[model samples]
Target: MTHPIPIFIGVDPRERAATNVLIDSLTQNSSVPLAITPMVTPQLEKQGLYWRDRDPKQATAFSFSRFLVPKLMGYQGWAIFMDCDMLARGDIAELWALRDDQHAVMCVQHMHEPNDTVKFLGEPQTPYPKKNWSSLMLLNCSRCRALTPEYINRATGLELHRFHWLAGDHEIGEIPGGWNHLVAVQDPAKAEESPLLHWTLGGPWFREQRTMGEGLAAEWFAARDDAFRLWD
Candidate 1:
């Protein structure tokens, strides 16, 4: 029997609705079965799985808790992690197929630098190298032994997000940029046609960001409406 593709998504109370919409979009577009879990920090903390203080630079609740995926998976198989504030416009199976076991982790590498000083919910935006690389990743869990709970709890933000625990740069792999096309930070041409679209600046979910990604937000709203229809 084929195992369902495993996926972990960041979930902040502030964006819980956004997370649901993302899950719906993924399930709607995927050709394969998926096991999607939300990385709700409070739940992880209550279980003693995550205990790190939120970094001042962290724009969202899952900024650091995301590093726990390997341990959460028992370091047994591959899994994908994605930020909640995104919409999958194509088959997630395609992204799953890009997983390369040769490397410990695979993600769409981006040189994104957002011009906005603040994002949705008035969160401060901090620029650093490889800022959004960890937002979406395919992990070879067995190869990511360095992501232990202890290390993740004490490690600096850059250490975890930039693949610092890996043996070297050679252990990191790259997926196609189209899979994580940042909404306003990347080329509009690509973000407009890309299979995956990320609202790195802010998504239309927040009242303040309702008009942030205007041209690129139709799919997000469509997915949002579809997801809420079940509840209403």
Candidate 2:
């Protein structure tokens, strides 16, 4: 029998609702088998890996937890790491099928600044180079020895995200933009075609964000309701 694909998601402990709904969306659309692991803060803490969210601009439970994905996989086979605020409209198998072994990591190279002044929970929208590239990654773990616990524990956000750990930019590969389409940033027409909808700033689940036009909020709500039923 074929083994299921391993997917590690970075879920902020505070955003359980969004995380669960993201899981539901993946399950609803994925054609391939998956071993979904939500890398919660408490669980990582229990394992002696603290959530070192030292940056004032970042506070998501998995803001830094995503770096642990490769280490957790024992630097073995390929694994996918995604932010919890994403909703999948296309089959995950399609994304998985795009994997190439030549590169250490693969993600959409989003190339624009965020329009908003603040992000979810009013965090300052600090725009840096290669923003959101780390939000969704297809890791070739065997070649990703640099993401070790010790390195990730002390590295600054820039060092971790700016391809400092890798040999050079060529080691990083690119994926299609539709796979990590950012909400509120992409052209409305293009956003509609994206297979993955990422609420990089925030989503409709928040009471204060209900009026925000996600264009795909309905799908998130429907998925959230489905996830709620499973837990009930």
Best by TM-score: 1
Considering only N, C-alpha and C atoms within 3 Å, which residue pairs clash in candidate 2? none
Per-residue accuracy of model 2 over 1-232 as CA lDDT, tens digit each: 6578899989876677888888878888888788999898788878976646557766576777688888899999999999988888889989998899999999999886776678878877867788889999999999999888888878887788776899898988999999998887777688777899888878887887764545477767877777677552
Q: What is the lDDT of residue 175 in candidate 2?
A: 96
**How do the residues 89-179 of candidate 1 rate in per-residue lDDT, one tens digit apiece?**
8999998888887999998888877787877777988777888999999999999888998999999988888888999888879998889
In model 1, the runs with Cα more than 4 Å from the true position are 230-232
Residue 144 of model 2, lDDT score: 91
Alpha carbon deviation, residue 52, candidate 2 (Å): 3.1
> Model 2: which ten-residue window has the lowest total lDDT?
210-219
Q: Top lDDT: which candidate number?
A: 1
Q: How close is candidate 1 to the true structure, as a TM-score?
A: 0.95
